[model samples]
Target: MVEKKYDVTIVGAGPAGCSAAFFLAKNGFKVLLADKTTFPRDKICGDGISSAALNILKEMEVLKKIESIDHHKIGYVKISSPNGRMMTGRYPIVKNFRDYGYVVKRKEFDYVLFEHVKALPNVHVLENFRVENLVYNKDKVTGVAGSHGEEKIDVFSDYIIGADGVHSKIAKKIGLFNDKNKHRAFAVRGYFEDVQDLSDAVEIHYDSQVMPGYCWIFPTGKTSANVGVGVFNRFNETKEAKELFDLFVRNNKYAKKKLKNAKMKGPLKGFPLTLGSFGSKRSSGNVLLIGDAASFIDPLTGEGIYYALLSGKFAAEAIKKGEPNRLAGEYYEKMWAKKFKNREFMPGYLLQTLMGSRIAINAAVFIGSVSKKRATNMAGVISHVLPKYKMIF
Candidate 1:
């Protein structure tokens, strides 16, 4: 058995885990950042990153690095309603953030972040480390026990930051995961080549069959795109993800026409989304959940990377306040609550439920089709460039 210790142990080296490790290591804290997979592993996603994520990438000095690589810049968005009405608009310009977004494969994006964090002096990077259990001192978490290949590893820390995805073992061990259908979703994605009429604008289709969810076509290159379909778990019980994906590509009018000549480059992959909901307990004892483990995904847009990165920043900030054993979890809870309060007070969960109704989707799309300003506003809200309150007001 290999024994290790650190000031903080972050499970899962995706965006959230990497962000936490980066910030903590920069602040001179020794951190053990572990992940089950190796670098450059493919993560199933729509591959669209908005301004919310860009703002932090800029702070991390990763934006410039990402720009140097091959990526598609998105300046506009197109929304198609269940009624077949479509509207297109530009991403609203926001202060302190870029007006446009980018689409890069998770395999590429996550690898860059992993490389950046590994170079830090106070960070130890562990690959292929699968956490199997949380070591608890009575009630409070003290460490984690997992396996690296055939070797057993036990890592102790003063605080545990669970940045792992939906099925986080730490969360389950701490009994914080809700696992309710209402707060969960599933999505399937595939890389497509020779997609006809690929554009810089990302496409979101709200077909009736996939109500409460949507289909996305995000361009990655001139002839290649990341195409997928996502559905709330509550409504996805009857069909497999692959079936929904097929239906979206062959039935949705615009998607059918655009994907007619496209060929899937690889097998379709699916992942579960732990959609964010208010009033959930995010922290207990010395463990705090961030990113998908904290359920930070947007209910309407299915966006998690931005919240994951943002929550990671908040977690590091809270831990830096001293007495992490006593105050870190409390600080994290309060900080994230205040920062994400908009989801409860604004049109976040409300809009998601309303969107499930065909009448609501059609009405909104019809209004957007007739009014360019309204279309822009809707796009802004969906892309998270503008607040949802602005659209309603």
Candidate 2:
């Protein structure tokens, strides 16, 4: 067994963990950033990086690396209703922020951030480390114990951050696991080459076959995309996600047209999403959760990268400069509430619930297609580039 000590032990080296590690290392903290996989590995995702997420990436100083890569820049969005009504418009622009977003494969995106963090002086980057449990000092989490190949490793830290995705071992060890399907969704994605009519716009198609969810065609190039479908776990309990995906590719009017001549470039991958419900137990004692572990994914568009990066920043802030009188967990909860979870975002959640019905989605798409302003508003809200209230007003 090998023992180590650090100011913080992050259980995952994905966006959230890397974000936290970057900030903490810059502040001279001894940080241990570990992951079960090696660098440049593929993560199952839609690969759509929101403008909001790009803001954080810029701060991390890794955005330039991503910009230098051959990535798709999304300037527009196209959304279609179940009955085939469609709205296509430019993404709404805000002052000082570019209207366009990017779609880079996770292998590249995650690796860029990981490389940036791994170079920091105070951070220890561990690959192929699988966390199995938490070490407790009389009920207060004090460290983490995991395996690295054949070696057992134990790390002591002041705080343990679970940035390890939805099925986080740290989250479960801290008793925050919930079985409710209301806050969960299932998504499957596959890359396709030569997808026809692929534009700079990210496309989302709604249908009765996958209500409470949508299928997305996020272009990765001029003629290819990461195409996928997401359905609420509750709605998907009796359904097969792969079947739903095949049906969307072969039957959904818009998707069929775009994918009719497309060739699948890889295997279909499926994963669970912890939708942003906000009420999940985010922190306890000296342990905190971020990203998917905290259920920060958007309920409407099934986007998590923005929230993941933002939550990582918040977690780092809480640990580095939190009030001395308050627990870091308490400060983290406050920061998360102020930044990501609040009353202002409630309308979006309500809309996500309403989106379960085919009639509601069709009506909304019809309204959006009526005018350019309406279309822009629809795209902005759905992409989380604008507040939900803006769409209603």
Candidate 3:
């Protein structure tokens, strides 16, 4: 097979890859976005996109398309403590900010991304093609070897991006996948139809039965919702995510109330969630990683799409600075850290640690209910609408 040359090659066609390709293409870089599966595929997630993620989509010029689809505009997150005490952290009305989040199926959300990126003149998208191996010259990644259907294709590029996801082949091949299981979280999500009392607010329940874990019900459509459960691996104790979600739905009181008339739209699906490890590495040689491949998911809310798009755009900006061949990984790492570490993940880690105790969660609910500003700030920080340091300093 002839090795085709391009300016940049990105693995994975999800939010990260597509965002990176779109930016790079607009900046006049010849880009290739490759993925193993076709669009409209499902990935296990909470299915909630914060307003920040939507703002990025607006910048990409695809927000209108997503808006035309059937989805719910989430305005706030309603929190129910283990003792059934409910409190809402409504997104504060920031001046000129779109004060709403979105809950759309990954099927529709990701398809819009793929279609938008594919229309770029300098961008080529390869679906159902997996990056089989990273082409390297003794640790310096030059490009990739991929399998599209039955044919093997070799593609060469000056820069490589591993946006493939948690099970990224590029990350593993580049020796970036250190097993930090303690830093990982596990979760399961599924769609349900005929759900009763489907509210515009995304509801999260913290039951004592699932300590260090929470169940979320996000309305995706008028009668359907995406329901899921999440538990930090540190306290997971070998419990199956699917079984845990089932038990929660059957047992949790508030869940029973809300889901009384709801029927499961599909079987519960589970997936591994990689968390951001502050001060951890995210690049090597001529390659940089983004999204789940770089463990950019928020530690508290599991909002990967926000970081995925941000990191992709940041990587493209860093690549734009590389004039004489390829950009070094350190530049990408530094850029990612400057933007996300102190500003994004630290507050998430703090809140995640605090939520470990049922008492702490109850206290938070009480305080947030009485103090509206504090509540909005806390909610804003978690939802990525406000800076994390707002809660700290």
| Per-residue alpha-carbon lDDT of candidate 2 for residues 1-393, written as tens digits (9 for 90 to 100) | 788999999999999999989888887779999999899888899999988788888999899998998799998888888888898877888765668899999998888889989999999999999999999888777899999999999999888999999898888888886546888888999999988998889999886666656899999999989999988876558777788898888889888888888899979999999877766659997788998888888877888998889888888888876545537888898888876777423565787777777888888778788888988887776556788766656
Clashing pairs in 1: none
Q: Which parts of model 1 are misplaced by more than 4 Å?
A: 344-346
Sort by lDDT, best first. 1, 2, 3
What is the alpha-carbon RMSD of candidate 2 to the true structure?
1.5
The digit string of per-residue lDDT tens for model 1 on 1-393 reads 878889999999999998999888888889999999999898888988987788898887788888888899998889889989998888887677677889998999999989988998899999999999998778767899999999999999988999988899888988898698988889999999988998889998998777667899999999899999988876557777788788888888888888899999989999999888886788887788999998888888888888888898888888887464578777888888887856532357788877778898898888888888888787777667788765555
What C-alpha lDDT values do all the predictions have? Answer: 0.86, 0.85, 0.84
Model 2, position 247: C-alpha lDDT score: 84
Cα RMSD, each candidate: 1.6, 1.5, 1.6
* Candidate 3 local lDDT, residue 113: 88
TM-score each candidate: 0.96, 0.96, 0.96
Poorest lDDT segment (10 consecutive residues) of candidate 3: 322-331
Record all residue pairs in model 3 with backbone atoms less than 3 Å apart, i.e. clashing: none
Error of 3 at 109 (Å): 0.5
